[model samples]
Target: MLYLCIVNQTASQNAEEFGFHAGDIVQQWLWDDDVDDSICTKIEDLTGEDLVDEDYGTAVDGVVIWWRDGDDEDTLADTIVDATTMLEDNGPVWVLAPKPGRPGAASSSTVQSAAKTAGMNAATPLTVSKDWNGIRLRAFGKGR
Candidate 1:
């Protein structure tokens, strides 16, 4: 008798570097004009998750929200609330904004304040792409 085994080895080894895991549902919100396809592809490939572009109001594992510095704080807070509301329990929200030297770049402190106003805790920043930086935030308790 002959024995045969099947194995899958194409999985990315750096998925965790981007804070992603297999089967995670990532929703991307575009508030800026620049979009990097390479970065998007890498995210999907590494995480093995579906990168959705629409806001369906359903629970998601994570959210990638891109915005500019000029965006109004009130509006940004509102948007963050809405976005975090749709996330699953313990799901993270990544707020991506322009880098410091880029046009319409928002300071990290400003982003942190906005997240706080939205009832979310802003974590340290990360590089999302060549032109954008991201800050991870988590929603407050259910009541908030």
Candidate 2:
């Protein structure tokens, strides 16, 4: 199955000591511009990957889109940017799976609790990490 990993580049850069470099690709695209034409084109051109508009939503801002293709990880970057990027980016943030029954799926309550335990304040934006089931809270704020 395939999984989508969305991230906010700006936030990710600010929160982490290691910032995004030339290879990092986020899942979101500017909402105001021609989402299909402008953003998708940029993704295709920059990352050599195609964008599918079927997953479009108000929450999506940028993405480090990923999916499994025959046991191979398909996406644009090497370093896994920290979750802080989402807060700075203001993403409705989402993960799109190619099929159901993915191993990473987690309950909403679990995500909330995990975030809280990590000192993720309500004022901070949320960052979701994709696991085998679906979504998991990776980090909250500029976690050291």
Candidate 3:
């Protein structure tokens, strides 16, 4: 498992890094144009299910929030909370943001602070793409 966590890994090689499972119904929060497309495709491929963003008519297995610096405002907590409406019990909320030194990157402290405010615990982060890093936020007592 540790060997699979290296940076610059292919989409499939990094699937476990995001904890995706087969048939998972992952809800997409906000998709900025700058978001990495390969990661999304890999998720769909690995799960054999398309990511759902509209209607949210069913309980979702997990959520992916494409975040940026501006998204870390007071609403960050609100957004995180809102994203949890239909989440599975102990479901994860992945906050993907630009890496440090990149435009619109949210600081690690800021991301963790918002997660705390939203009543979630930010877990070990993963490299989502060359320019993006992701933090897996879990409800207390919910994740590894």
Candidate 4:
């Protein structure tokens, strides 16, 4: 899949592209200083709820994961599998990683490989932010 799929898009546009819905209990994984606040805030605006991180104790309707190049495929694959434990079936799992030229950036192929290893289907990379790219993962042969 191509990188930077969305260009000159508003923060709200980026959030909408994330596929979130009203009343969706979204969990944000691996929150860090690098995560884009504009996008995150827009997500909240759309969902009308604050995003729950891994520290939260509850099931989620969807998940947003921030990943980096240093985060190995195996560990990430495991994280993807574990993320399913608290997610509703067919819920979306979004993996956001640094784009090329950014520090600690991971390639789209790596994310795709991890998703496959975790038994999920990886969608094309989306330009979520200036420094990051994202992909949506779903149960194998499920969310086409």
Q: Rate residue 60 of model 3 by lDDT.
A: 92
Error of 2 at 50 (Å): 5.1
By lDDT, who's the top model here? 4
Global fold similarity of model 1 (TM-score): 0.78
- The estimated TM-scores of all candidates read 0.78, 0.24, 0.86, 0.87
Which model, 2 or 4, shows the larger lDDT? 4
Question: What does candidate 2 score on TM?
Answer: 0.24
The C-alpha stretches of model 2 lying farther than 4 A from their native spots are: 1-25, 28-60, 63-81, 86-89, 95-104, 118-144
- Please give the lDDT score for candidate 2: 0.32
lDDT tens readout by residue for model 1, 30-106: 64447656556777876687688745666788777877888887777888887777778667678888888998788
TM-score of 3: 0.86
Q: Please write out the lDDT profile of model 4 over residues 1-144, one tens digit for every residue.
A: 233544534433738778788878889888899888877887888889989988778888889989999887899999898888899867878999988999989988999999999998899888887888889998877847
* Candidates' RMSD to native: 7.4, 14.8, 3.1, 4.5
How far residue 18's Cα lies from its native spot in candidate 1, in Å, is: 3.6
Worst 10 residues of 4 by lDDT: 1-10
Name the 10 consecutive residues with the lowest summed lDDT in model 1.
Answer: 1-10
Model 1 residue runs over 4 Å out of place are 1-15, 140-144
lDDT of 3 by residue, 15-130 (tens): 65677789889998878689888888888888899999836889998889888987645677888888898888666689998998999988878888988999888876677778
Candidate 3: segments with Cα more than 4 A from true spot:
1-14
Clashes of each: 0, 19, 0, 0
